[model samples]
Target: MNSFSKLRFRQSIFAKFTFSFIIVGLIPLLALSYISLNTFSNYLERYAVTNFEQMLLFASKNVDDLYTRYNNESKLMYSYGTNKGQILGETIAAQTLEGDYRLTRTVDDFLQTVLYTDRHLQSVFFVFPNGAYQTVTKQNRTFDFRYQFPDREWGEVLQQNRNLLSYFPTHLDNYYLGSNQQVLTFGRNLLNVVNAPGVEGEIVGSLYMDVSMGAFDEIFQQMMLNSKDVVYVLDQNNRILYSSDRASIGQTYVQKDSNEYYRMQKDNANVAWKIVGELYKDELVMRTRKIINTIAIVVGLCIVSLILVAIWFSRRFSKPIRSITREMAKVESGNFDTQVTVQTADELGLLSRGFNKMVVRLQSYIEEVYVAQIKQKHAELNALKNQIRPHYLYNTLEVIRMSAVANDDNEVGDMILSLSHQLKYVLDYGQETVALQEEKTNIEQYFRLMELRYGEHKLSMDFRFEGDVLSCSLPKLSIQPIVENAIYHGIMPKSGKGTIRITAEELADNLLCVTVDDDGVGMTEETLHQVRQKLESSYSLDSGGSSIGLKNVHDRIVTLYGPDYGLEINSTKHIGTSVRMVIPLGEVNASAERHNS
Candidate 1:
């Protein structure tokens, strides 16, 4: 039955290996496939939008360049008559009704030169302040002589702001008779150039140039990648100046449905116009579908292949592991002689060999080290028992003595009882740590004995413990020795009554600081220096005067906690002495609990 149980355990391990391997391989593959599909679609959409934005930027740049060219040509026309000894502004300023025909011929010839330079120019008109105008057109079209300049909106804008250039959105060429071509117009007030310095010139007339929509058509057609894609050129008010849909021209461009298309716009820097492009979403989906399908098929194949490989690998991997497991079971059942056969030089075989070596060493350790430690512990306990016997005998004798003395002097009897208690505490070798309250009780008894031995008024003891500090743990006899030093060396040498203040408080960084301060005579600087040096030295064997007890307490504290914790002595000659001991609260408590256990 045991063998069958072991066999079932090994089979369960094999099954677990296969299942874990499948899960580990399958989850990431499925996640990657899902991520790849979504990532490819997002990437395609982003790529299309970026291309559309770049195309609109190029179209806007082209439109800006076209506007700049026409602006420069208009300036050239304004300053053309300079070579004729007078500018066009001056000629228009000097116009009269009788000489208007000759002025018209000259202005028409100058404007014709600019009209023929670009085939997109529809017409150029120079309208004088008196409401008369000279016009030229690409086609030899007649002009509307009845049209008045000062009454028109664009004309009035130029007349009011003599230095302003005005631009108009697409409208029918109404200045030319029987003409219906859609054209964008530019109107600028022509200023007479003043030869004298710091003199402002007055407006002579206004120059108006009209450009056909065919100029923007060429730009849009070159950038369009699909027939469904639409482009619009909009003025500052969002009204369409030109669009792929001719009917939408001159109307406010409403935003297209975002779900069906990707839209981008670029603003022209030279003009208050923007180029907008809308690309169909169907094109982006069509481009990403093929990549997504390919990824799906590849991921499916990888998952299928991973399952077959996992099953085969788990079977091979479990055989050697089963042999090791059976040997481990034997070891668990107290058969340390058991060994596993290493069939290969791989890591599993190394594990089998290491297992056999570990068992040999464990058996050797139990025989050689473990048994010897137990024997040593027994011997030490016997020694401690032997030492406790003498103390027990001494305490019994002292108790007999105290009982006999109690019949006469009760004070002396009580002091004898306190001495017995102190001896018991000092002699007990079992506990290395005691609580603050226990140590405090021991100190109170010692002071009681001192008070009874000497006059009660000679030495006054005060203990101040802050907030549960009496429950904190410290090494046994840690404070008692220092109190003994203060009494003998500090208080006894003083002339009058002396005070010993013992305070225990929790300091920062999990430290417990206990200060034994006395108003007795303090040491001189040189003697205090020597005493501090003795306390700091680890190997100092100076059993000199009162420092003996101080050094012992300091050494014990330093040994238990690290070197960072120890006694610090501050003294002034003929004034007082204070000895401060800082110890780690956590380590002392832990040590006390460990020793008790």
Candidate 2:
């Protein structure tokens, strides 16, 4: 390995931080991006499957509806006479007029009446067992000698399967000379309907209705030609009932081998036919590829940028500490007066100050070793207290700064009083705890400042307390961070007016629960999961910009109470979010402990 690689391999803080930061940061980001893409792909596929199935179902229903109309027409024709045998008893030979057989005329008129009644019926025919037949078309009428049906196979099949409705494929019938056209046939047995006691009725003849295929041609064409999806309607025998590829019609589909395809089926009960839709996956993914690729590229660039930033910051931080190390090395060699100077007000500056104090302390230790322990303890306690006071003071001054900016434009002095009340509450740290009512008042003043800053009507709040739960004491500012998160991160980002509802209730075993619910653009599941994970673990301000406020609130609650008490986040996308705070109901301090004991 090169010298640089060897140096990075060592357990140096700079190399470890840089490497760990990049690995810890980029892995989850990349993994999450990959998972999200796959999730979206699955979602799209499911959506497409639903839409295709619905369309196929609709097409099947349409075909069924058409078939039902014709089926019902056949039933209507069978019920032509009031008596069961009235219509079927009339024989063609019996219709004699003026000593000339008027059988041809009587049969022709009967068939023509049926053809003309329904526009879809192209032709009609009836054939009896007595070697006589009559047929009628929309444009012509014909009487024929018993020639038997042209499709003799189907004819024999129909006779064998008597009294049942049967469907026929597209075919040319030469029964009429001038009226030969392609038509779909629906035929059934015409039997004597009369019920005579102890007598069996005989079959009179067979009735056939030839429907023009042109009626359904338009429907099938519209379904296929308008969309890129492929559709196929199949019969019970798996024959192509209708297809976008007209040539494929009448061909059987035996589950052809193909990948990246989805199939959906529907049954047209009226016709006893099945409809199948074969949708190709390529057609679906083509439209979504651009979006997926864009997201992948963006995520990749983000990871690269994060890695570069980690490297730059790690180097920047290590350089100053290396300088401090060298100065400490000089002090190790009996240079008690040595001091390191750092101007910036950061950890490095604090380290330099400590280093300076340590050098002075070591020099004093040589002269007064007996008092060193006492002096060091006192100095450490005073230093910690001093550090805490400034941080609290800085937060108070920030609120005052915001209030002062608003005070310049308003004539009313209510803003100043609210800021004063907030300032006084922070400065008066004589007690580490406060009454529940005083904390509520402090929250009210903070809300007033927020209202003036954002203007009225942008946000609203409703507070509810169940049975004196508000009387219980809580740490000062425990609820303020939660309320602030609801406004800034939750409600403020929404498009419409937002409402936040805060409710306090007393639970069993001296536990108090406060919940804040907001009407806002709620978090996505991934975001909610991330936030919950942060709340359950150690809270860090450096996690992200938006989660900082929530983490602070959760950490404070958990720190004051036990691990069982903290904040819980529940959210649904586009609906809203609810944050519940659980804590013990009392002041959290030594004095409260003493009083209870």
Candidate 3:
């Protein structure tokens, strides 16, 4: 059964087409569903966390504003009293001296009025320096007068920092009997106003305000999205002052498991506390899972329908393809006379007609275009070889002439050697481009020959090249012809010693410019114009004048590269002549290197 299945997959177009349609349709559907699900989940998670952070920030701000209002009220005890211009602090201080029941009743009434202003305030206490205290409460609870003010740690802290307010963490109300309510406390010492200069006032007594956790609960209730959401208000030491879960209050808030929840936190601006919110992760995943399952079901239905359609289409099309395949096999065996019969007037018929036409044209092109190109290439190569032979013969004769002229001169032997090297380079048809350094060496050899020939003319040469310019590539024998022209036309005609400066430098747009300047007899403006006109023209008859070498160099540059690159000439009659040649740099060098390799 497995072998039969493999044979069906290999030979039957219907089976192959069905499998291809299934893969092409099913894989992308699965991949797209997976990607979309992940993307939606991530976006949903980020959006939820961002909203949670904003809610936490709003809650923190509300908590800060509440604490700030209470802190300001605590300072109001130092304000001047409503009666007789006496400060409230001084009145509270005088209660220590009066020791009367009516005065104690008046003070208690004032504290009760302050407590009634905010429903969150649970109790207020004013403890005197002698450990005697007065208190008020929201409910009728008996006071614990036996609780000594000087004995508690919070009392000592307030007594030490007389001018600053101190905060106490969440604790039960121990100062009142039968009151087990949780409260956050603030305490400060009241100071005696000093009228005499340099007389520091003493501490009359300390004031304490107790705030209930209902204040935090009311603010957090508005921000809860669901019951499963957790909110916590923590002190600087990570101790929970208030939480949605009441059992966790007064305990340290350890971080929940991060993989199962999204948590956000903000710090209260008015106090050293942090507000935190956590949301469940499974809720977000459930939403994404439903979308993914729907997509998967849709994709499965599409795959099954696609397989049925592919089977019908493949059966209809495979017969025409099989006929074309048989004819193509005949063509592969060099039977160009074969043709496919047009079975239907659809694309299959058009393909059959196109195949017949293509075979006929292919046969004709093999006889005409292919054979002619080969013959033309052979003819050109042979003509080039014939032209190189005469130049080789001429260089050989020149070497012999030099040897015959000065046999005793040691420099003549060296000249012959240089000539032979020049002949070999000139005849090397395999390499069309050479490195700039090799061309420079060839110019030096040519200049040596000139020096030997014109012994009394006193010709000198100098080369200045920029960084790595010598490693660049140019057409072989390109510079030597120009250098020879400069020596003959520019230097030989001058009256005094002549100096030739050759400079190579890089230019913009990946170009290289090589300039040859000679301090010799230069051309008049009219002559220079004529020379430029001849170089710029597309065709010119050979005149064998002094500018022939210049024209040759210009033609080779323009032919190899485009017309935008060529030789440029500038000359002053009394001063010198400058011939600048521009050529492309990096790409040309790479092409030349590839050809050589």
Q: Which model, 1 or 2, shows the larger lDDT?
A: 1
Question: Which number leads on TM-score?
Answer: 2
What is candidate 3's lDDT per residue for 345-439, written digit by digit as tens? 33455466667766666566567777775675566556545655645675676778577667766677767767766765565434577788878
For every model in order, what is the number of clashing pairs?
0, 0, 0
**How displaced is residue 61 in candidate 2, in Å?**
7.4
Model 2: pairs clashing at backbone N, Cα or C within 3 Å:
none
Tens-digit lDDT track of model 2 for 1-597:
999879756767788879888999988998899899999877877887787777777778888887887777665445554222345323432333233355566556667777777887887877765635567766654634444563566667567766667777755556665555666788766655555343234566666888876666655654542244567766677776566766666677766446857767787777768877777777778656767888889998999899999999888777768778888898888777677866443445555676677677767766776678568747865775664564566567566656766768342345665776676666543344555666678878878888777767788888888886555777677777778888888888898778888888888898888888988888999999988888777645775767677787777777777778888899988788999988888744554332222
Task: State which candidate, 1 or 2, has the greater TM-score.
Answer: 2
Best by lDDT: 1
- Best-first order by TM-score: 2, 3, 1
Evaluate candidate 2 by giving its C-alpha RMSD to the native, one decimal: 18.5
On a 0 to 1 TM-score scale, where does candidate 2 land against the true structure? 0.45
